[model samples]
Each structure stands twice: as structure tokens, then as C-alpha cells.
Target: MRERIVVTGAAGFIGSNLCKMLLQEGYSVVAIDNLLAGTLENLPEGVDFKKVDVCDSDFSRYVEGAIAVFHLAARNCLDDCAKNPVDTARINVMGTANVLQACVEYKVPHVIYSDTSAEYEGINMFPSKIDSVKPMSIYACSKRSGALMAEGFKNYYGLNISTVRYFNVYGPAQDWRRVIPPVMSAFTIKLLQGESPFIYGTGEKRRDFIHVDDINRFHLMLIREKLIQGGTYNLGSGEDYSILEIFEKIESEICSGIKPIFKPELSGEAFRTLADISETCKTGWTPQVTLEAGIKSFVAYTRERLRLG
Candidate 1:
């Protein structure tokens, strides 16, 4: 019999991708999402979707007979968390606790958690690793707290657990407000309208952008192969690109005539982020998409979505 997998945030960008991969691999998937930051249209047809939040869902019912539970649901929006820290905590922290409780009660064989590089805030270090994490924002703090809870559950309840700290993930279905999407969208919108593309704060801030496809592959490979157990690994490409560099790539490809206008930098945004995935590298998983390729793919997706090209 095929092992059943319970995936929270199944309607989300990465979650839907992971669910699709799992289904392709012939695993039965019970996907649950509250549609907070995800859309029902994002998930593939035939997925077992429950329109309930992790905090409110009867998670045990989903985890029952499932061999693994992949917890990916969270508030996810940094700006939203900054605006309403309490609500963010309730959903991210409390919701995670609920999921963990369900996993423990159901005796799920393994749990794979989705953590974030934002958790390592207030640190001035390059190539941040798993051991070095200092959450800065309420969202990051909540995620860190959830990670600790996972650890406790593993130690006390004997639930196998692993967490992956994902760096900047960009691809299709990304929200328009996010950095990459907005940049691409704004540029395309302005270019077709014959206006200058805008840049934020001289556009020097660098970030490690990993394609979501790589992340999806990593989740399936890690869970299926069991290369990691009770450990945390960073999922990134280990390559850093600046905001200016990304803009330049997009403009050069789509609209070379238009220049970029500078704007003040946004507060609370990470100035730089680089992931050192040496731990996951040992497991033979590395990001395959280059930043240039990723930017092009995002531009193409956005163009099609907006009917700009």
C-alpha cells in the first residue's frame, strides 16, 4: 500500500507544487488549506482539499493513516505580521502547535516543516546556516517558536521531524506585492505604457532567490529518501543577486529602452541574504536554476498572466 501524506497549505504556491509532486509519485495526499494566502484555483484537480485553517481543522483526521505530515501553513506575510503581530502569532505559532498535536496524536511517522530565512534576523552574516538563527519580525519569531515546538514534539513524543529554512523563492503564482513579482509586473506595466521602471533604494540589496520548482523537488526527494531525520537544513541556491541586477536582467530582456527610477528603501526588508546549503548538499540536493533563468521564467509567467506579451 502507498503511504499517505498530509500536506497543510496545499493550495499555496509551494504547497500546491509539493502536492502535485507527491501525487505524481503515486502517494495519496490529503491537502488542507484555509485559503488565507492561497487560492483554490492554485491546487491541481483531484487533490483532497479541506477548506479549513490548520488551527480550526481536525488535523488528526487528515493525518490518520498518513505516513508523513508536511506543515507549510502560516501567516507568511511579513508586512501583515508587522501590522498585526498578535493575529500573526495566533495563526503561525498557535496553528503550528495544532498541527504538531495532530501529528503526535496520530503517530505520524515523520514531519517536514517549512521554516524561513527571515527567522535569522538581526544577524550581519553571509551564507547563514541552520545553527545561526535569530528571528527579527513577529512572523519570524512565530516560525522559530513553531520550530522549537517541533523539536519538543520530536523529543517528547518520539515524532520524527525535520525543518527546512527556505531562502527567497520566486516563480509562478507568487503574490504581486512580493519583490520579484512587483518588479516584473511594474516593469512590464510601465514599459507597455511607455514609462520608466522604478527601483527601490538604489537597488543594491542582495538576496538568494531559489526557484520554487527546486524547493518542490527537494521536499519530495527528502521525504521519500529519508536522507534527513530530526534535523534542519537550509534550502537555497547559495547564489546572491542584487535588486538592481534583477531589474537589469528583466529590462534587458523585455524593455531595454526604459530606465529605472529610484525610490526610498522599504523598512523592515532584509538588506542581504545568502544561504549555505552545505547540510542539504551532503544529501545530494542542490538548486539547479540560476538567478538569471529564474528572473526570465518569472517575467514570462507574469507576462502571460497580465497579457502584456
Candidate 2:
């Protein structure tokens, strides 16, 4: 009678890591991903995995009899989504709606939906509050639309759902295959190869980073504690660092003399992101990993991956 859980986007970075943690905790896991941006190499062992897009209306069958569902699939590149708003909405919005519909239909008792701090892109306020959101870009709009869809299910169907807005999440197994890879991964990949990576913008844009391990800890809490199941939590370290600062941390580990090249700022990205995690803090969860530790591990992991391949 081990509770089975279904995870969308299981082959992606966060999804794969979450699956690993769930398996270690003895939960029966079912995973789904489209493989468009995710890879099987990131897919965890000891789970029921399916190659399917969340947008597929028939995707509901995957949710049958699960104790809970974790929906993490999305068309989630800000710059890319800005360029392709239609596809962005179709996947981030409609696909989320489709998954919630399945959870409702299949009688799944709970769901955990992954949101983003990008919802606060338009606001100039420091330590952005979860409730004071003002999403500006089409990408942010799409993510917000998905949350609205989930809200509808909560109101009408009485479905238990926990939503979380993640700040800049980093660690090993991050989605390096992204059209525009995450800053940490992109930099590490290039630096590991003795190449100077381009630093988009002036490297002064600040970001609140939370390690994937910390996020997974929160995810476990959402599953075990009913108190964590009904509200949106901001997953961040409550501290902000500039892009250049993060680069320096990574560089300190490698000591590469290759200076980064500066480039024009990318559109659809926020100037600063700092999370107000007070609400989430009440859940007794705090981000445990340090930036230096996180970056060092990531660098090591990336180096090993490259060496093996």
C-alpha cells in the first residue's frame, strides 16, 4: 500500500531530482515528460516513466489512483516564451489546466504545482511578496494563467493543492539543455572547458537562489504536512546575489583566468529577484545549502559528466 505519486516532467532537472528523493523515501512514483527539452539521462531509476506531453488531453490516465500528483512540466524559458507566447500559453496554461483536470477526475487527493518568482518581474519592490505579484512578460503571464487554472480547481473541486514560487533554483542535474541554459549551468559548462562564457547584461542583476535540495525538502513537507497543502510558498534563500558575484564564486573554485564577456541584457528577464519566504518559513523549512557549496557541487558534477562523456 505504498502511496503512488505521479510527477509531470519527470525527465527534467527538478523533476528527476524530485523523483530520486521520492524513490529513496519509498514512494511509488510515476513520471511523465515530453522529451522535447528533457532527457532520459536525467530521468531517475525505479519509477514508472512515460514519454508524453502534459498538454495531451488523454494524459489523465496517468493520474489514476495516485495519492498525489506533482505537476512540473512547462514551456519554461522566459526569453524563449517571450518570443513564442502562443506556444507558451498553450503549454504553461492549457497544459496545467489539463493536468489539474486529470487530478480532479482521477480522484488524486493532492497536488503540488511549481510556480516561479518571475511572477514579480514587474515590481521594483525588494524581497517580493507572494501576494504582491505583478507579472510583466508573456512568460510570466503564462505561468500566472496556469496558477489561475489551479485555483479554479481548488475552488470548484475542493482539490488540495500547494503552489510554490521558486527563486533561481540551482544545483546538480539542472536542465542544461535549455535553449538558453540557466546562468549557473551555462557558466559552469563553459568555464569547465576553459572557455569564457558571455555574461548577459552588466552582471549586476541580482537573484535569490535556492538549492534544489532545499526545494526538495520543502516538497517533502508539502506531501507529509497538511498545513503545507493549501497555500502558495515562496522558495528562496531570503538573500540576493548579483550575477557577477555568483560568477566569482564559481570562478574561485576553478580559478580560471578567462574573464567573462559582457553582452546586452536579454529581454523578458527581471532586474532583481529576492524572495520573501516568511510565509514558507512558517512551515519550518529553511534553505540549508550555501551558494558556495551549491556551486562547487555543480561544478564538480558538470566536470564529471563531461569527463565521462
Candidate 3:
């Protein structure tokens, strides 16, 4: 029998992509989602999918016999989380506790927790390392709380958990429906439609963008090698680009002749984010996708989607 792997938030961008990759690697996947943020169309075929919320009391049954679990479900939008901090805490903190409990109950061998680079919002340091974190926003705080919960599980229950903090991940199935979408999706979609995209702030906030494929490659390595137990890894390209630079790159590909409309800076966002992946590199898993190649493919993917619709 194929090894069983369960993924929460399976209908979302990263989860869906991970499911596709896991299926390709011959793992029996069980996908779970509440459909709050993710869509059915995003889910790939050939896996057992359950419409279940992470906070649901009965969510543990899905973990039975699974070799590993990827807990990705959370209230992650900055604005949304700011507006509904209570709900964010309920899902991010409490829901994570429930997932960890299930993992312990089921005796699952390992768990991969989906974390964010937003943990560094309050830190002014460049090339963020995993050693220090100071989360400022409600979303980041809640995720930090969840990370603390994971730490407790590792220390108390010996759950063998691996936490991955992602930096500006982008690719297909990217969430473009939020009130404020991701930068790549927002810029590409608007440009493709001949509409000018909005650039929050001065369009100079630097971010370390890593292609989703590179992230998934690291994930696969974690599963296959099981090299790190009770470890935290930073997944990024180790290169930083300003928002305007990204816009220019995308525009260079589409030749849209459209300029971005600058607006007030969004609150609770860092001025820059660059990852220090030295420890992760020691695991022999280096980022393979270049920003230029990644952006070109993303532009093509977005253009094709717009054309189809």
C-alpha cells in the first residue's frame, strides 16, 4: 500500500500544489479543507478529499494510519486577520493545537507545519534567520502562537515536527480572489486585462520571493530524508527584489504599457524580507528556480488563465 499522507488546507494554493507533487511521487494523499479560503477547483484529482474544518472536533479520524500530516490551514490574510483577530486566534492557534493533538493521538510519525516569513515583521534585521522572531501583526502573532504550540508538542509529546517558514511563495493556483491579492497575481492579472494594478505603499518594499516548486522540492526532501526532527527551516531564494522591480519584470514580459497606481502603505508589513537559508542549504536542498525564469513562467501562466476565462 502507498504511504498515506494527510494535508490540511488542501484546497489552498500551497496545499494543492503539494498534493499534486505527492501524488506524482506515489503517496496516497488525503486532503482536508473547510472551503473558507480555498476552492474546490483548486484541488487536484486522485486523493481522498474531505470538507472538514481544522477546528472540527471529528477531524482526528482523517489522521488514522497516515505516515505524515501537513498542517497548512490557518487565517492568513493580513487585513482579514487584523479585522477578526479573535477568529484568527481561534483558527491559527486553537486549530493548530487540535491538529497536533490528532497527530499525537494517531501516533503519526512526523508532521510538517506551514509557517510564514511574516514572523520577522517586527525585526529590523536583514537575512532573517530562524533563531529570532518578533511577530507584530495579528496574523503573525497567531501563527507565532501556533509555532509555540508545535514546540510544546515536540518537547512534551515528542511529535517529530518540522516547521517551514516560507518567503513570498508564488506559482499556479495562487490565491487571487482576496480583497487584496498576492503581488504577483495582482500585478499579472491586472496587466493582462489592461488594467493598472495597485501598488501598496511606495512600491519599494523588498521581498524574498521563492517559486512554489522550490518550496515543494524542499518539502519532498524533508519527507524522503527525514533529516531534521524538531527543526525549523526557512524556504526562500536568498535574493530580494523590491515591489517595483517585480512590476517591471512582469511588465517586461507582458509589455502591457501599464503603470502601477501607488496608494498608502498597508499596515503590519515589513520594509524588507530576505531569508538566511544557510542551515537549510546544509541539508543539500538548494533553491533551483531563478526569479527571471519563475516570473516569465508565471506571466505565461497568468496570461493563459486570462485567455481561457
Task: Provide the global lDDT of candidate 1 against the true structure.
Answer: 0.82
- The residue pairs found clashing in candidate 3 are none
Instruction: For candidate 2, give the lDDT.
Output: 0.90
The predictions' CA RMSDs to the true structure, in order, are: 2.3, 1.0, 0.8
Q: Which prediction has more favorable TM-score, 1 or 3?
A: 3
Whole-model Cα lDDT per candidate?
0.82, 0.90, 0.94
1-309 per-residue lDDT for model 3 (tens digits): 999999999999999999999999999999999999999988998989999989999889999999999999998999999999999999999999999999999999999999999999899988999999999999999999999999999999999999999999999999999999999999999999999999999988999999999999988888888656558999999999999999999999999899999999887788999999999999998999899999999998988888888
Each model's total of backbone clashes: 0, 0, 0
* Deviation from truth (RMSD, Å), model 1: 2.3
**Residue range 1-309, candidate 1, lDDT tens digits:** 877898998888788888888889899888999888788877887688888888875656778888888999888877778888888888888888899999888888889999999977678888897897888888889899989988888888888898989998877766564543445456655665567877778789987878888998888777778656668989889988888887777777776588888988877888888998888888878888877787777777776776843
Name model 3 segments beyond 4 Å from true.
none
Candidate 3: worst-modelled 10 consecutive residues by lDDT: 222-231
TM-score for each predicted model, relative to the true structure? 0.92, 0.98, 0.99
For candidate 2, the per-residue lDDT at 244 reads 96
